[model samples]
Target chain A: MSHAIVAPVVLPALVAAFVVMAARFDLVLQRTLSIAGTLTLLGLALHLFLLAGDGVPRPYLLGAWPAPFGIVLVLDRLTATMLVLAQVLAIAVLLYAVGGWDRQGRHFHALFQFQLMGVNGAFLTGDIFNLFVFFEVLLIASYGLFLHGAGAARLVAGFKYVTVNLVASTLFLFAVGTIYAVTGTLNMADLAVKSAQLGPEQSGLLRTGVALLLLVFSVKAALVPLHLWLPGTYGVACAPVAALFAIMTKVGAYAILRVHLLVFGGDDLPTAGLAEPWLVPAAIATLLLGTLGLLAARTVQRLAAFSVIASMGTLLLALAMPGPAATAATLYYLLHSTVAAAALFLLADLLAERRGAVRDGIVAAPGFPQLDLLAGGFLLGAVATTGLPPLSGFLGKVWILEVVRAHPAWPWLWTALLVTSLLGLLAFARAGSLLFWKPAALPAPVDPQPQARPVLPLVATGGLLALPVLLALFAGPIGRALEASAAQLHDRRGYVEAVLGPGRSAAMVER
Target chain B: MELLFASGVGVLTAVGVYLCLRARTFPVVLGLSFLSYAVNLFLFASGRLVVARPPIVGPAAPGYTDPLPQALVLTAIVISFGMTALVVVLALRGFLEAGTDHVDGREPDREGRS
Candidate 1:
């Protein structure tokens, strides 16, 4: 691991800290600084990605302390992948901000950059405590962005979003505290090492700690029972902010995948007893509820919000499935859902803006039929979500079924997933019908800025849709990578070895 | 000592959850604030409550409190404060615009109004 590689990860956060101090007249300078910071971070991520391709690992320790002592930053294939995806989305969203860039929203742009910094830091950080800090940074930025514009609706929804997250953050703290109390270390790698020595009772306590951590992440991911804040709040936010948040939910999913699957043991194979046995059923329920919400939704934005919830369910389902195949499916689904949800949300925002209001129903946009231009795109995305053939989503589902087919008890889980995927298709079909097939009376005084629409949103939508298509086309290599990562995830020894090196602690390697 | 603190947190959590389930936005926000306090304390206590010995480094600190949890709790405190302010502002805005603060809002009186 290269020692100097941590500078890029730290620079954006430094810029963000500096940005908070600038005077009003330095607004232009602040935006410039923020943009430059993201660009620099993007460059570093790309550079490290290239390095990973060459089979080099990069680890940077903060404050000159060694790993398991001071904070550490890790740069590997997974971190590189998430970094690239996040930076691309961050840059696209920033460009999209060019449309309504004004002094009133300058703070928003600054905070957006800060949010990106936090996201990148979280992905790169090698320590658990650092992850909490980064999460706080991102959440604070999100609160500002959620309330950036508009009037009462945005504020009301924003309040709910903020309140729920505040509670989640607190729970997150408790989880971290509990873990530290048990393991006597805050470094994730160190915790994994120390935790191995614990007895069954101690392990159970750690499981509770992990469950508490999941509680916060579930709220962030908008799992079924906890998703009430999403629809109304996300439905009314302006287009760019909504698009930005479309990707933010994935952060929670990412946490579940990273912390539970990586930092903690027992989530791996051969330890089905690791987490709760209820996760699968809960995931299936979430999927059904989300799809149902979509079917019942009236407006485009609300439908998209519900779709986000359903996508979360699908990701969870992917996680709950058996073996390497299931892990592979989870990875593919994560990429697919993030892209599709983002594109659909951005498109919904455009449609809403075209209409005077989101309440105007589907008829507001007279060019509803013209959306057929995106029919092929939506169909491809829908097929992936529905687990239909030739799409990555299908490949994922097939893999999961292959792994779990022999287990008689798991049949019901499979059935639930199949049913929900079908329901998802039905929901999308309804959206298609409303947006394309059915028509209603146009509202008075249509938008004047129809033809010369903003170029950034178009680019944003195009970029989001393009990713999954590329993923499908190159599914072979991507699937292989995911399977490999999942195998690494399942076998605790490899992760422990990588983080702690061999022969460091014989008792730690007792597993 | 730890048990008492944990129990207090539990009570705070229960109260917060009950308040959150209420119809009006103000009580919900208050409930959330209380819940956050409970959560913050819970997180702090999760490290198992040692006094006058925070996890920061010093020469005589053989049994220093875990620094990582404290750092995490600090961030949580700051973020929760921001969240509370934002939620309060948002609730005020909604109250002004919709003429009510209940989440459901009488189902918008859709029946006879139109």
Candidate 2:
């Protein structure tokens, strides 16, 4: 609502659109525009972080219209956090892309900014219909990024990515339609208020609509059965591009989190009452399959993609757990997993370049000490992936365990978590052996590719690696903040009040 | 009227699913496109089909159809169009490079095996 909240989202959007129409020039100007825009956005994120302590849910009304009639953006604690994350990742990827600068440099940077604009906009927007709009924008930009400067492999994979997303978008539309027909509004806050008013008679249709909505997100989030597109496509995409897309899955997870917190109210949704629920089972299956794929996979990129699936399972486990701690744990794991996945993808890209090969399978490309850099990053990331200690990942698991410990259904969930985590650890350990400890005698004579000068990617990779560890150090404050976010999210009425204004619930119900 | 529309959707979904399970990439794409149509129509129907009342809200239209669903569905239509274009291009590229659009990575075997 305040100037601080609006600036980060608005500035990048303006710059992105401007660059799209700007005169084509040398690679330097294009890179400058992107780097400048991202730097501005990052500055805004830090400023908003400082202002978040002011304790107001900042609202920005686009085009000067009221809440229900117009699109409004909210800068809450969660929204600001996601904004900063998006900017941080965007900057890293842009900097990394500089190493590969060619004719495609301008278009790549411009599209990347547009992608961030869509992401930050989606995070902040107050209405459901607007969320769909932002999602479409993000997807369109992703299509461009996915196929940028790759061979036929990327083209095929990009097609699958677009098709799957289109199906999900259609589902999103239908869910919105059904919800509006029942509730007469599309504002998320309004939906929350109106959904609560459905009497016992109308609960069936309402539940059905919510179920349909979750199905849409399930495909987007790459839940086990629906995740076929991710590994193939992400494995095929260029490294910096794949690293950028590492944030895409998080967008879907964030959507699921928002829906649970806002529309489903964390207590009254269709899946709320059932113990030994479907998501828990689905999540366990996902974790097992992902870890298995990690162990079995020969390619660096596919291994990282499967690792993402495993992390999603952890987040879902948190969701399946009962009460507030589950939500808090989901937040913690989300941050940890996203940072780790991005770093791994970046490292994979670096390895691909350094070894002078781009094959998906790990062929022996005479080892370099630089390989150790990737190996170490991969190990730390893998440790986080398995929820090992001395990292943010472990702290998140402990938080979830503390909450789920006393529940009557604790044993099954705990066993699932513990076993799947061990499987993850084993899978990564196998990958490390295959990658790093191959006999030193087999070193083939080096015929490296014309060395492309790379500086920014290394810096970006190092930054991403440092982030989770740094956050781990500040876990107490961050955890307290996450707990605050969880409490506010659980208090559904506070959200509705923030968006729909006070006392509008009673008035809407009388209709 | 609603039942007829619902049946149409069901039929579309059934055909799409069947086609998608086929061996060729073209058929799979067609199947996906068919399924996308069904999905979009189904979503539009979720707001409950109302004849003749478009979702336009103004002073004269106090009892207008729900504008929210219309806006959302409109956006979906444009996005689906983009995705379809992308899919077509991909299929073309696949056919060009690999000479066939089969779902499985390999060509059919010589011993009457797929």
Q: By DockQ, who's the top model here?
A: 2
Model 2 lDDT, residue A413, Cα: 69
Per-residue lDDT tens digits for candidate 2, residues A354-391, read 65553435655456546666778777777766778888
lDDT of 2 at B6: 89
Candidate 2 clashing pairs, residues 3+ apart or interchain:
A1-A58, A1-A59, A174-B43
User: Per-model TM-score of chain A alone?
Assistant: 0.88, 0.93
Clashes of 2: 3
Tens-digit per-residue lDDT, B1-114, candidate 2: 988998999899889878777777788788888887887787677667787774776677546665555566676777777777878777788777766676543478989475
| Residue B66 in model 1: lDDT | 57
For each candidate, report its DockQ versus the true two-chain complex. 0.52, 0.54
Kindly list the per-residue Cα lDDT of model 1 for residues A1-511, writing each as its tens digit.
4643675556766786787766335766776887787787788778876765543335576776767777777766667777777887777676666555434455766677778877877777877778888887787777778778657666666666776777677677778777776777877667766776676767667777778888778888887677777887778776667777876788887777767766664433222245435556667778888888877878767777787888788777667555656766777777777766766766676555554444425433454423555555556555655667776667666666666564456778678768777877887776666565444444434444546666666666677767766777898888777666566556555555555666544544322
Provide backbone clash counts, one per model: 1, 3
Q: Indicate the docking level reached by candidate 2.
A: medium
Candidate 1 residues lying further than 4 Å off, grouped into runs, are: A1-8, A14-39, A54-57, A101-104, A267-272, A355-360, A363-365, A368-391, A403-410, A438-451, A509-511, B1-11, B39-73, B103-114
| Predicted structure 1, TM vs. truth | 0.86
